[model samples]
Target: MATGWAGDGAVQDQIDATVEDAVKRARNQLKKGPGLTHCEECDAPIPAARREAVPGVRLCVACQSAHDEEAAFSGYNRRGSKDSQLR
Candidate 1:
């Protein structure tokens, strides 16, 4: 049962929306087209194995790691919980 102003199944709807957003984000991040032999950011050579493993690979391992680290922190909270909104 939903409390206060929330309608029935509101929590489930929120959960499903969050999951859908995550899925869309993941899909958008997927690389497309041909893989590059060199790292676009560092100009380092990308190994053949990596190119084969990750189709449309652009960055070398080091650059990709750095990129991933940079993208790890997300300031926006998609869930928009009451506690988070208060802060």
Candidate 2:
């Protein structure tokens, strides 16, 4: 538990902060307001079923898939691991 310069429970604190930040980011990203009939990014027609299924949806299936892929590879290292810090 001796973390040198860091206080007790510093690692846990960092983990908790990372989780909270991710939660906040996800909540903030939730689409709000009315759903768009056309994809905002590609101008493709958004299916009615999709619009109803996901309220406030702005992007079509393909565009949303691409966006999700980009988001998945954000490469954010919030844990502050020694290895990552060293690099």
Candidate 3:
């Protein structure tokens, strides 16, 4: 049922990459540094709820949203592969 580059490590690669990204992101999220403060970017109050919800959380909600908007990286499963060639 796959089509185009969808067949080139398509589903499996995407799934694997997703899992990998999740693991990496989870690792980063789990990492905690000394902190209890406001958002450096927007000076918004870092809610206790958010600090608790995300252990090492930085950036308030608004700042986080804006940062996400500005983040330039693509998702983990975006491209097929460098070695892949369309034909």
Candidate 4:
């Protein structure tokens, strides 16, 4: 479903790349290390389960959801990443 100069599936490829980019970001956080016992922003007690589940997590579930939403709004369009390859 490529819509630009790229051949078929370019759009889908970009989508997959975008998803991969997000997953990488989350994975990078894990690589850093687990977060503190309390929430970084609110100081709420972080559950042991969450801490064990996702290392290097900064925000609690509620805060993380908000943070993710904000990040989604801030993401730059990657259309050029593919189009640039054409040249």
Candidate 5:
């Protein structure tokens, strides 16, 4: 109901915004078509197994790992918890 200074529905607003943002990010990360034969980032050949396993995969395993690591520090408070804000 009331969220003090934020007023009514503020928490819900934040939740909705977070969910929308996550959906947008997920959509952006998804590949539009079949996986590439080579890694887009490093120009290495993509393993057939990986291509089959993950449709539309663009980066090879090593590049994907590095991308994942970088994504982990994307500077967004994905969790959006109060504790995370405090840190």
Candidate 6:
């Protein structure tokens, strides 16, 4: 049944949209083809063990750590605040 002003399937549509967006983001992050032998950012040699452990790896430990730090601070919140809940 419809809730509030939205139609019957409105909540489901929102859920579907959120899932689709997450999948799209994940797919974009996935690496295709073989893993790089060197770090693309710092040009450091990516260890053989790393390459083997993580298929399609591109960055070395240092560069990957920096990249992870940057990504963590990218300010994209998957969930909004309670203000959004009031909607």
* TM-score for all models, in order of appearance: 0.56, 0.55, 0.48, 0.50, 0.52, 0.51
Candidate 5: tens digits of C-alpha lDDT, residues 10-32:
88899999999999999898777
How does candidate 3 score on lDDT?
0.76
Candidate 2 lDDT over 1-87, as tens digits, reads 577999898999999999999999998998877799999999999999999889799999999899999988857687889988988
Question: Root-mean-square deviation of each candidate, in angstroms?
Answer: 6.7, 7.2, 9.9, 10.3, 7.3, 6.7
Model 6, 1-87: lDDT tens per residue? 539899889999999999999999998888766789989988988888888888799889998898899878844445877866676
Tell me the spans in candidate 4 whose CA falls farther than 4 Å from its real position: 1-29, 75-87
Total backbone clashes of model 1? Answer: 0
Query: Which pairs clash in the backbone of model 5?
Result: none
Expressed as tens digits, the lDDT of each residue in 1-87 for candidate 1 is 547899888889999999999999998898877799889998999999999889899999999999999998798886889988998
Which candidate do you rate higher for lDDT, 1 or 4?
1
Across 8-70, the per-residue lDDT of candidate 3 in tens digits comes to: 668888899999999999897674864457888778789887888777777888878878887
Candidate with best TM-score: 1
Question: How far out, in Å, is residue 68 in model 6?
Answer: 0.8
- What Cα-based lDDT does every candidate model obtain? 0.91, 0.91, 0.76, 0.79, 0.89, 0.86
Give the runs in model 6 whose Cα sits over 4 Å from its true position: 1-29, 74-87
Evaluate residue 55 in candidate 4 and report its C-alpha lDDT on the 0 to 100 scale: 74
Cα deviation of 78 in candidate 2 (Å)?
4.4
Clashing pairs counted in every model: 0, 0, 0, 3, 0, 0
TM-score of the candidate numbered 3? 0.48
- For model 2, which pairs clash? none
Task: List candidate 1 stretches off by more than 4 Å.
Answer: 1-29, 76-83
Q: What is the Cα root-mean-square deviation between model 4 and the actual structure?
A: 10.3
Candidate 3: the clashing residue pairs are none
Q: Residue 87 of candidate 1: its Cα lDDT?
A: 85
The window of 10 residues in a row where model 2 has the poorest summed lDDT is 71-80
Angstrom error at residue 28, model 2: 7.5
